[model samples]
Target chain A: MYDGIVQDLIDELGRLPGVGPKSAQRIAFHIIQTESFDVDRLATILQTVRERVRFCIICGNIGEEERCAICRDPRRVPTAICVVEEAKDVVAIERTREYRGLYHVLGGALNPMQGIGPDQLRVAQLMTRLQDPTVEEVIIATDPNVEGEATATYLIRSLLPLGVRVSRLASGLPVGGDLEFADEMTLGRAFEGRRTVER
Target chain B: MYDGIVQDLIDELGRLPGVGPKSAQRIAFHIIQTESFDVDRLATILQTVRERVRFCIICGNIGEEERCAICRDPRRVPTAICVVEEAKDVVAIERTREYRGLYHVLGGALNPMQGIGPDQLRVAQLMTRLQDPTVEEVIIATDPNVEGEATATYLIRSLLPLGVRVSRLASGLPVGGDLEFADEMTLGRAFEGRRTVER
Candidate 1:
């Protein structure tokens, strides 16, 4: 800590996720020294994000209004709703330019260790969104981790009786990634999900 | 990119040093999602720092007033001033609990290729500070880089005629760092700076 405001800035920066003390120090100095960096714009955006941005009423995804862009998009298929653990996941899926369905953000996956359960999530909201008769399939696009798997399993069990086709995003070897470097579980999953190539 | 404010926040965060697009997204989300995170306070601090913080009139270190905390503190040896390239360097030296002297921040090292020279730095301010009869010794704690070495050489040439004793920070193997993996230059410096054990 150097002085009053400097130390305070470092402390605040350090509180951000993945920003350790050393990183916080570097960032604080960066903000101070980088003459071209617009600190005012960043602060304003932060304030605006807090004030204007909110969860979509229908799907729990982040939005400026009651409905998110995907929810409001007429081009998206209403018959399919992709369920994800967070709003960021929605962005990741969108980046692929493949999925053209509405999204249902669960807010977070079920993590029993962290005292986060289905009740703690937007699971109720997801269920409510599925009640629409136009929905045909629910794609589980949660992370390939224990908590995400548990959440997907719970949702699958719950959605089976709802008379909807439930599906999940496939986990396999990523493109351009080394096959030998892949973990045992990913390799096993790849083998399990093997499909016949069309001639 | 995310919807509206989310994307805006991510963009703003990405402008920060060392924060890549992914890290920016993560930080932006963290700021929006964290329940206890005081966005208001962080914003206030950034604004306050920008408003209140200023370079010291004398030494060019960051200060709320005309003088920095170290400069204001009478306990520090006024006769011995440590020279560094940036305000961050002052904090780094302060952290060691070794140096209890005033500091002169040069703003940046002499980078001739990049067009930074003696005139661009706080060279005149440093020379003025050294003119004080009470001031005896000047310690150069600039980074051990080409630019820093050039700046040090320039300072030494300039200060020698003034009859003030000038010293430089020692270059050697870092404490607790593996010697086997140490670069040749570092190993050579370590050998050159080898100190005899007191009997």
Candidate 2:
């Protein structure tokens, strides 16, 4: 489709999660045509990210330091650890400003079809973290999908014997969403989790 | 939304064409999480593309050397020169395998709203290329939209005096496209350019 190095650039760019071939070509051309585009800077950052970024030792979250920002922050409540499937989920929770507790990233949810079992996840590290006497509750904030639910179920069974309180994130229709558009499963969940309004 | 360098990487990726903030974050996280992902390779290619690729001196098409592949290829018909709006457009036409002529990249279309006119394009270079005694035809393959039509119109006016056979890529409903969904302008063009059966 394109010359040697140009085609190579497009192929490499297309390897990213969502970027397809057309997008890769468009991006490659943009980098080539836009004189003001900082190609060196982008390249340098990519190299730096690869070199400097690493998973936190305590939690599976990504950061430059040994421990993630949430784990390092003294103000975050250590008693309640919110467990999520990935580091990106931690960022999503952080944006809400609702949860002021620590996080434990599982790296990924369990998917038996992909051969990703409990051992493949950071479950062992999470269990080890729960041994601390001060930590009281574990919040299973994994995604509401099938794999996430299975992972949450496994974690709940494992943590119940340890005498720690376990809770899963509620699933229901999203706020400000049209009820008519809500799928049957979600509508059912919303009905089951209905709470009385306080005046 | 993310930590220092991670956020910076996301911002840089978001600057690319068609990449939004969420997609940038997803790509950044993929790079961070997947150790097998060739970050260094991608970075090196980015640097190489910026350092090596330059527009062809003969026509404005992009290449690693002074002349583009088409311009250097002796097998191509030297008598016909196809004029295109961008280097990408040249690739599109090449894939069709219908044209074997040389190419002259205009870099962009004539858009008065954006302050782009004949001066901003490679019009002079095209005119100079037309002066070759062996060149017999000049095909305008600019896009079908407004700016492309304006550029084709401008080129037609400029090339008519030089006695070169000036022509334009036909406008009409695309092949295999739904005629019912075709716009009025396209339908009009199709009617105006209707060819007679040669039986």
Q: TM-score: which candidate is best?
A: 2
In candidate 2, what are the lDDT values of residues A1-199, reduced to their tens digit? 7889999999999999999877888899999999999999999999999998989999889998999888899999989888888898777667656677788999888999999999999999999999998888787777766787788789988988888877665556454432223454554454345332211
| Fnat of every candidate, listed in order | 0.74, 0.82
lDDT of 1: 0.78
Tens digits of lDDT, candidate 2, B1-199: 6678999999999999999987898899999989899888998999999999999998999998999889999999999888888898777767656678899999998999999989999999988887788998787767766777788788888988888887665655465432223454564454345332211
Reference-based TM-score of each model: 0.86, 0.88
Which 10 successive residues of model 2 chain A have the least lDDT summed? Answer: A190-199
Each prediction's DockQ against the real complex = 0.68, 0.75
Tell how far residue B155 is off in model 1, in angstroms: 1.7
Best by DockQ: 2
Any runs in candidate 2 off by more than 4 Å, and if so which?
A: A173-199, B172-199
